[model samples]
Target chain A: MNRLSFLAPVALIGALLLIWQGACSILHTPEYLLPAPTAIVLALILNAPILALSAWRTLAMALEALVAASVFAAVLALLVSLSRTLDRAIRPLAVALQVTPVVAIAPLVVIWAGVDHPDRAIVALAAIVAFFPIFSGAVRGLTSADLDLERLFDLYGARPWQRLLRLRLPSALPFIVEGAKVASGLAIIGAVVAEFVAGSGGAEGLAWRILEAGNRLRTAEMFAAILTLALMAAVVHLCFQALEKRALAWWRGR
Target chain B: MTDVVAALLAVEVDYPGRGKALGPFDLALVSGEIVALVGPSGCGKSTALRLLAGLEGPTRGTVRRAAGRGETSVVFQSPTLAPWLSATANVALPLELAGVAKAEARARAVEALARVGLGAAVNARPAQLSGGMAMRASLARALVTSPRLLLLDEPFAALDEITRRALADDLLAIWREARPAIVFVTHNVEEAVYMAGRVIVMTPGPGRSAGETRVEAPTPRPSGFRTTALFRDAAEAISDRLAAATRAAA
Candidate 1:
C-alpha cells in the first residue's frame, strides 16, 4: 500500500477516538454505559495478566481449529474430487453444516463434549464453522487445473497420483490460501461465539472474560477484552496475508 | 505407407447433445512431414488435432497409431505453461512424468530451453516471460521429448505478427533436427501455406475435408519466401478452397 493509504486508517481512527473521548467527558457519561477509549486502555493495563492468559487460550483454540479444519477439508476435498458418486453423496451434508449457524449448534456441542472441558467443545465447534470454505476452496482448487495441462498430463500418461501431485494440487494452492484466510477469521468468530454460548462453563477465553466483566458492570474491561479479540483477528489476517505473498509469490505480479 | 506415423480412418466425434463435432474425416501423417489443417472456426481443425494427439476418441471410426509412449507432443493455441513453475521446470515436466530422473530431465530441459532461444529465461516463471517467450517455452517443452509426431493447434494465433513469424521460423529450425511428422492446425491461410508441406482445407462444423493443396516449396523457406509467387500461389489455392468451403456452408 502507498503511504497515504496506510496513514488514512490511522488518522481516521485517531480522530474518531478523540471525538469519543471528548463526548464522554463533556456529557459526563458513566463508564458502565460507554467506556472511553482511555478508560478501556487503563482497564486493559490493569487486567493484563488475566486478559493475556484468556487471549492466549482463545488464540490457541482458533489456531487448533484452523489446522483441524484444513486437514479434514483437504482429505474430503480429495475424496470428492476423485469420485462423482462421493461428491454427490457428500455435498448436501457439507452445505447443511455450512448453512447452520455455529451459534445454533454451539450449545449442543458444549453439552455433548461434556462441560468439564468446554475448551475442547469450543475448538470442535470452531472447526465446524471453519470447515466449509476450506473444503469448497480445496475442491475448486483440485479441479481448477488448466484444461490444456490436463490434456498434457494425459498425453504424458501421468499416473493418478502424479497428476494430483504435480498439477492439481499446485493449481489449488492459491485457492487454499484464500480459503484459509477466510477460515482463520471464521474460526476466531466461531471460538468466541461458542465461548459466549458456553458462558461460565469454566472456559478461559477472551469471550469468557468479556462475559465475566459485563456481569459486574465493568464495561471498560469488557470493551478491553473485545479490543483484544479484534487485535487477535487482525494479527491472524496479517499473518495469512504475509503467507499468501510468500507461498504464492509466483502467482503475484501476474 | 509403411512409414505412416499415424492416421484418422473415417474418424468422427459425436458430443452427447451436440451431435457430430468432427468427421467422418480421414488424415494420414507420414514420417517427417509437416501438414497443416486450415478451416473456419468450429470446423473441427482442433478436434482433428486432438484426435491425432489421442486426447479424444473417434466415435464412428478407428484411430491408427504407430507411435508409442512419449512419441507425440502437442502445443495448443495458448502457451499453457504451468504458471507456478519456472520455464525450465515446465519444460522438464513431460520427462519427469515419463519417469526420467529429475536431474536428467532438468538438464535436458535447459538444453531444450536454449534451443528455443530462452536459455536466459530458464528460471523465469510463465508470468514473468513475454507472450512470445512463454509460447517459445511451450515449444521447448513440446520438443523436449523429441516426439516422432508434433501436433500444433493454432499455436501462434495469439501472438503479434512479428512474434508469430519469428516463432514459426524457430519452430521450423527445431523441426529440422528431429524431423517429426507435424500436424499443424490454424485459421491463418498464409501461416498454413508457409509452415506445412500440405495444407488441408475443411468445410464448416461437423467438418469434412474440403480439399488439400501440396506446397512444392522446400521446408523453412528462404527469407522473403512470403513475397514469392510460389508462396502466393500456394496460399491463394488454400484460401480459395477455404472460401469455397465457407460459401458452401453458407
Candidate 2:
C-alpha cells in the first residue's frame, strides 16, 4: 500500500504531461501561447550552460540566505524565550515583517545596497522573507517543553544553560526542522523576486533570464526557466524532508 | 536520631488568584524512610511533594532540605523521559547536568538502566517503550543520581493493574537497595500502604495533613504481599482515614 501510494504521484505527473502534449498538438496551439513539453525540453538542453549558471546563482543566494536566517532566528528565539518582555516587545515586529510584501521592499533594499553589491540586497531580502517561520517555529519549540520535564530538570538542579541546551534545544529540533522546510521555499522565491525587481546585471539569475527571454519573445526558454525554478524548489523541499526524517527518526507515526 | 532529609513546617502554598492550594501542612522525611501522601484529587498531594522537592516555595512558613540541589530527584506521574533521547541518555541526563564527564555519565547510566531491568532496552527511545518500560526508564533516571531524597508524584498511577503491581514491587526492591528518603504521592490506598513505611492522609481541598498511619508490615515486602491479609488491613485503615479526611474537607 505504501509503495503504491509513492508511485501514484509519479504516475499522475507523467499522465498530465502526456495529455498536455497531446492537447497542444491537436489544438495547433501557438508556441508563444503554450510551448509544448518537447520545445521546453529542447530549449532547456540548448540553453543548458546559461540556464545552469543562472540556476546556480539563484540556488546559492537562497542557500546563503537560509543559513543566515536560521542563525538569526535561533539567536532571536533564544532571547525571546529567555524573557517574556522581549517576546512581547519583538514578536509583533517579526509578525509585521512577515506580513509585509517582499516585492514592495526589494527595490528599497536594492537602492540601499547600491548596484555594486546587488547580491547583498538579494541576500538581505531573501533572509527577511525566510526569517519568520524559523523564528516562530523555534520560539514555540523552545518554550513548549513539558512542564513536568522542566520541573524534573529543576529538581535535578540543571543550570539555566544546561536546561536550554540539553532539554529545550532537543525538544525544539522537530519544530525547527518543520519551519525550515517552509522557509527554504520562501527563500528561493525571495531571491527570484528581488532579482526580477533589482536586475542582477552581471549575475544574471534565472529570474533575469526569464525577463530577457520574455522580452526577446522566446516563450520556450521562458517556460524552461520556470521549470528550473520548480525543480530547484522541489530539490530544496526534498532535502529538508530528508533532514526531518533523519533528525526525528525517534518520533512515532507521521 | 536519623537525619531529616526534608521538612515542611506549617507551610502553605497559594496561587495568586486561585486562593490557597495547600497547607498549613507539617511533615518531615527522615533518612532511609519511605513516606506516602494519599488523598483524593485536588487534595494537594502533588503540591506537597513539589514543596519537598523545592520545585515550588511555600507562600507562608518554610521548607527545609538537608540534601543539596544535586542530592534530590523527582519522578512525575507520566514517564517524563525526553522523547528524542534514548533510554540511556535520559538516564544519564542528571549526571550530565551536574558536570560529570560524558563517558562517566554514560557508564553510570547503563548501570542504572540495568538496575531497573532496562539493560536490553538501553538504545530504545521512550516512544518505542511500552507504558511499563517507559515508567521503568523514568524510575532509572530518577535513581541514576543515587539521590539522598526522591520525590515521586503518583509515578505508577497511570499503569494497568499488573504493570502497576510489578512496578510497585520493583520500586520496593530499589528502595530497599538504595535506602533513600522517599516521599511518594498517590491516590491508591493499596499502593500507598504497600510502598510506604508511613502513609500521611490529607484533606481533599486546600490540602492539609489529616493523620498518619505506620505500616508495620515489614521491609523487603514480598511479591505476593499485596494480597496478604496484613496488607489488606493496613490499606483498609488508611482508606478509612482518607474517607474521613475527604468528608471533612467536603
**The best candidate in terms of DockQ:** 1
User: What lDDT score goes with residue A179 in model 1?
Assistant: 94
Error of 1 at A15 (Å): 2.9
List where candidate 1 sits over 4 angstroms from the true fold.
Answer: A1-7, A251-254
> Taking the tens digit of each residue's C-alpha lDDT, what string does model 1 give over B127-206?
88999999999999999999999999999999999999999999999888889999999989999989999999999999
Worst 10 residues of 2 chain B by lDDT: B217-226
Q: What digit string (tens of lDDT, one per residue) describes model 2 on residues B1-250?
A: 4889999999998988888889899998899999999988988888888888888999999999998888888998999888878899989998988889999999999999999899999989888899999999999998988999998989998999999988888887888888889899998988888889999999977898889999887777866887888898889989899888877766
Itemize residue pairs with steric clashes in candidate 2. none
Look at candidate 1 and tell me the lDDT of residue A153. 98
Q: Give the lDDT of residue A246 in candidate 2.
A: 81
lDDT for A127 (candidate 1): 97
Candidate 2's DockQ:
0.59
Top-scoring candidate (lDDT): 1
